[model samples]
Target: MKKFLVVNAGLAALVGSSMAEAGFSPYYAGAAIGASQNNGSEAQFCDECTGSKFTMHKKNTGAKVHKVYAGANLNPVWGVEAEYANLGDTYSLDMYRPEFGIPGGRAETARARQKTRGIGLSAKANHRITRKTSIYGKAGAFVWENKNSMDYTNLDGINEKYKSTDRGVSPTVGLGIEHEVTDRISIRAGWDRTFNTGKGDRFLELDANKNVTDLHSVKTDTDMIYVGATFNF
Candidate 1:
């Protein structure tokens, strides 16, 4: 993470110095919506993960993503951009933890959610493929923050909650295409991936009467694809 920060700072300083000497920069900003897919192999949750027996269930996978970015298009082939991206709070998972003590097989309802948001700064390189079309790639650093929460409801109408929040810095890489429909407007399609948070080692635990337990683990790394319009000034 420190390396990512150092690299970006150096690049930013270089860009600032170059633009200062040239006295001008082409600036633009845009918004996009996409699907953020949670990698299956990277995160796994089990109710009895720390016990002799384990029960596992699937969590929400593909989630809606939104991003807004502004940048200086320093030249025809290179630029620098800053972006804010969010996965909101729509993704969730539900499970049931059964207890034999209830006689009629009583169980508690369980639900959990992990929401992700980040701020990123990137250096982009564009390659013209046609008269009005180009392909581009980007590399950047993002401070990814995630909020994880869990809730439990018993048959007797009691509620309990567990929650945790953490942030990490990771590298982001992407490839995209742009088509200029007019001199000042363009259509873009892109895919990007943010590296793992490296802190998925925690779990949520809810205990009722010291007999039944519900546990859940979470991770919030992201892979996404998006389409949006860019308005250039």
Candidate 2:
């Protein structure tokens, strides 16, 4: 009986130690720097028409903007984040209204240079899958700032400028893993996604006869891949 009691006590102590090692909480904050890809698509029409009334038509013109960013993460399980992503100059397909008959019988080419900066906040939840690894998903809001410049040599052999700063709310979802490399340090990696909102879309007018219009009613999604070192106190 005495030996059995001792064995049970030893097992209980071991279990307690394991639980201590797993140390989890409702709050944690960290910083991460990563590479992200912004993928967006939209359609356009004359404001008077409900996208169906326009004599000009283009189905789904899209763009892919790739960038690198650094940011801090705060986890209250319902917290906020501030990140800055720099997009150098990403290009995409620019279509025009084929129905509009031109004087020279030539279709205009539409193209431009674009860069984006994002500042945002989010809410997140963490699920511990193992002693040193966890998975998480997040959703939140953001304000994306866009700057666009256009070149319409096809229309007037001249350049134009169209710039605007718009406000938008975006939602994000992500998964993450944490591994303890030591008692004071750990390595973490995660992927996050965000869907952008209405004011997020902008239009560009190249020349009087032609324009490259952008309609981003459909949300733009961004994917992030990051690995960072963390300090636990």
Candidate 3:
């Protein structure tokens, strides 16, 4: 009876250890939503303004900030992940320059529709703090596309429409903490920012007369804070 009891105790210990270490799979997927801010100064032309006091927002149908990603765990500490971010939003900026137009110059209105989206792959490194929790950091390059349109309305009620597109590769970095909620599920909260984004700019055509004729140059960028969940397989 004593010998049988000793064998059973060893098996129990082995099973418990296995359960504790079995949560991380070779593959995983996750999704997150949070707030994103678009920090691009609105620039004006034709009716030339020195500085613009206007702001823009990234418009989304669901959350202000959203992202979806999937990755593989090469081992306990290293892996790779690919992500897609929806940074689409809109805003309008109106400026009045006392010296820009002649006497009784019309108000300048710019109704802007901005679109910013990105997809990229990153190398992730992990550090386990406990059996169920870990913290990680990643660095990668994202090929981001920025497409925007603006409708300029003059005081005289003359309107002009223009479209602009900008696409390039930008360096991205982020850090986060993740905890296992269930054996195959986990939750994470993180912040990620891309650097040196493109400014989708378009220009206006004006004669020497300096009339508020057509379109102009504009700028845009990306920043976000997110909380998300993941599933392992």
Candidate 4:
């Protein structure tokens, strides 16, 4: 019986040592921010014009957009994050009316500044390669809305107006690193890229038969750099 007790005590000591040497836990929650950019394109033409000689007009624009976001991390090397950001003016282009007898005077202009604001939720998984550093990858979807408007005057003293709102999905992939400062705090830095696919609509005012047209499809790709803190719970 004494020998059995000694064996059991040895086993318990070994177990305690192993637990002490295991270091910190695996689960964490945090936030990050990085540089961002956005690009979009749209086109509109008279839809009611049935004549073969009708003119076609188009416009394309692009610019740089920047914003920031915040999120949280979960267990099993996987976490969820929510971020909000706004992109500045990217770019703009204008196309004149085509060379047809469509009687369309000036082409559509891609000017007028634009902005973006939205929130995104994503799921991420991370692997620890060392004691103080780890690499992680994340993929998720986001819903974003955009509003664009343009105004111009025609030769016939008529005013033209165009505005649109679009909502779609944005998929993202990112790589990041985390450094632990204490048992309750850590610093994180990461870079992520996302592709947004969708289109924006437009409204045109024309006296000839109340014309309406669908604008062009727009796609955007953005890169961001982020650094933030995390609290382990």
Candidate 5:
């Protein structure tokens, strides 16, 4: 019985030492820089006619993004993080309308641009593949602000500028791999996507009499790939 107790105590101590060597930190901070792609569609409809509509599809509209984050590890497999991200400007679309009835076709041009930023809170789950390497998945909600602007020139040689701001919360999901370089430092690469980030709000095109003629709406999802390093305290 005494020998059995001694062996059990030895095994318990060994397990405790292994847990200590796992390098779980209570708090950490990190920064990342990456490129983002915006994908979605824009629709234009005549306010007066129910069936008159036009739709434009957008894909791979690229932008630059950067994020700073801080988090606490609750245990070996769970953590929570808060982050602020600057999602740079993206060119939404360009449209040209040609007037074929004129002696020489005159083209009317329209262009759009969008700027976005957000803050998010996430829950992270980790699986250790080895002593120094782990893979993680995160799910979160992001509150974002998007600013959209359009410049249009018509056949009458008149330029019209329309601007709108939209704010909302979006669901964010990500997967990442991390490798520990030291007890206090780790490097990671990840991919994150925010769904239906900028939705709702309609931009109205008005006629000369100030009557609403057409309504335009844009919706998009944002995807980002990033590499970063974190320091634990």
Candidate 6:
């Protein structure tokens, strides 16, 4: 009985030491760079004119995104994070109103560009699948700002430029997998999405007397995939 007790005590100590070595610290910080796609539609309508409407569909507008985040682990399974991200730019081109009656039979064209950035706060849940591998999911809210500009040209060689800035808060969600390379360092890959990020309208046209003649509105969602490294403290 004495020998058995001694062996059990030694085994307990070994187990405790292993647990301590594999445990995560309370705080961590990381940075990630990735590609993002914005999905949405841009529409222009003239309430005062008949049959003067145009709609542009934007699908797969890709951009580069980078972000930095810091978080505290409340326990082994739950944590919270704050992040700032530069979500990048999306561009689109549309051709409207083909002038078949004209000699060249050309069409009126419009080009648009939009830029976005945001800060977010998130609650994260982690599940460990192995000694060095884990998966996580996060839900959060993001406050975003969007800058939009458009240039339109008509068959008569008249050019118009319009700009607008819109700001709003949107819901965000993400899922990821992480692997520990050492006690203090880990690497992760994930996908994140922000919904209804761009939500507002812009004036696309004005009359000779400076009255609002045409209006444009757009709504978009952004998605990103990234790989990054984190350090625990």
What Cα-based lDDT does every candidate model obtain?
Answer: 0.70, 0.49, 0.69, 0.54, 0.74, 0.74
Local accuracy of candidate 2 as per-residue lDDT tens digits, 1-233: 99999999999887656644664432334566666554543232123223532233232222333333233333322334444544322223344422255444444444444445566555556566766676656666656655554444343444544444445556656667777777656678877665553343434423344454543232345566676666555
lDDT of 3 by residue, 1-233 (tens): 99999999999877656644945677999999887665554442323443443222323222376889999987778899999987655223434432254546546556655566889799999988887899999999988876656676666777887776667788888899999999889999997877655643533445567554443334444667899999988
For 105-213, candidate 4 gives per-residue lDDT tens digits of 5433223333345667788776777776677788887666656555544434456666766677778777888776776677878776667544533233346555434
Clashes of 6: 0
Off by over 4 Å in 5: 1-20, 42-59, 89-91, 101-105, 201-217
Q: How big is the positional error of residue 195 in model 5, measured in Å on the Cα after superposition? A: 1.3
> Top model by TM-score, which number?
5
Please give the RMSD to the true structure for each candidate, in Å.
9.7, 8.6, 7.0, 7.7, 5.6, 6.2
Relative to the true structure, candidate 4 reaches a TM of: 0.55
lDDT per residue (tens digit) for residues 24-88 in model 1: 23887889998877653313444334452213355545567889988887687789989999855
lDDT of 2 at 222: 54
Model 2 clash pairs are 138-172
Per-model TM-score versus the true fold: 0.74, 0.55, 0.72, 0.55, 0.76, 0.74
lDDT of 6 by residue, 13-45 (tens): 876566445565679999998988866544422
RMSD of 6: 6.2
Candidate 2 ranges beyond 4 A from true positions = 1-20, 24-30, 42-91, 94-110, 155-157, 197-202, 205-219
- Clash counts for all predictions: 0, 1, 3, 10, 0, 0
The global Cα lDDT (0 to 1) of model 3 is 0.69
Q: Model 6 off-target regions past 4 Å?
A: 1-20, 42-57, 90-93, 96-98, 101-107, 156-159, 201-217
